[model samples]
Target: MTAKPPISALTDHLGYWLRLVSNHVSASFARRLEAEGVAVAEWVVLRVLYDVDALAPSKLAARMGMTRGAISKLADKLVAKGLVDRADDLEDGRAHTLELTKAGRALVPRLAKLADANDRAFFAGLTAKEREGLKRLMERTAAQLGLDDIPVS
Candidate 1:
């Protein structure tokens, strides 16, 4: 048999390294959020609603770069969880808006703390400056890729 040509190892790929770190960070944060009875996507919705107070479902769908059906599904789950309120417009019966319930508003800061802790734990090996540099690089890469949607998953 002829000798095989040399090939790069998995560790030779930048994507492999990035995926390693990303998966660990994401899974850890997800577990923390799960313990608090929230999914990562649901936490994203709650955080967004915390900023805007209320918004039309269509508007929220557009803002999140998600389909209306996806937003509706998430909203249904949140409504059932008592973390969000869905109300039809007083003037337009067909139109509805969504907002965080009082409990959701109260939970946001706690969730935020959990998020910060998770980030710190995963990045503990990096210095502050290094972390900032990494963040800037990642942000620039994402911007170059036209990736503006928040990472919900």
Candidate 2:
């Protein structure tokens, strides 16, 4: 009988290591956001709206690399939370635009600080240069892989 080739170990793949780190990082951030009464997905929406005065849901969806339906659902939740306002577009009565409310705008900076803290806690061992290099490498890898999906979770 012919001997079978040995199977590769789970840790042999680069993806395994990446996923291990990603899961931890994402879970940590999610918990922080939850404490602030926002989901990771909601934070993504609010972060995108931070600099913009208003935008169509279609445009926002495009920017977020998410489906319009998903954006609409998220918008509904934000609206109910008093974090976003949905209004008719003056240029196109049939269309609508979304803008962050005063409360939403106020919360963004605080959330941003939380994000910063989370990153710092997770990457405290890395020097500034090391952090930048790691970020650049990840960006290059994502670009090479055509990873356009915005990380909502």
Report lDDT (CA) for all predictions: 0.92, 0.92
Q: List the pairs of residues colliding in candidate 1.
A: none
- By summed lDDT, which 10 consecutive residues of candidate 1 come out lowest? 55-64
lDDT of 1: 0.92
Number of the top candidate by TM-score? 2
lDDT (10s digit) by residue, model 1, range 47-76? 999999988889877877889999999999
Per-candidate clashes, comma-separated: 0, 0
> What ranges in model 1 sit over 4 Å off?
90-93
Per-residue lDDT tens digits for candidate 2, residues 52-137, read 88889999888778899999999999999999999999988889999999999999999999999999998999999999999999
Candidate 2: which pairs clash?
none
Give the TM-score comparing model 1 with the true structure, all chains together.
0.91
Cα-based RMSD of the predictions, in order? 1.7, 1.8
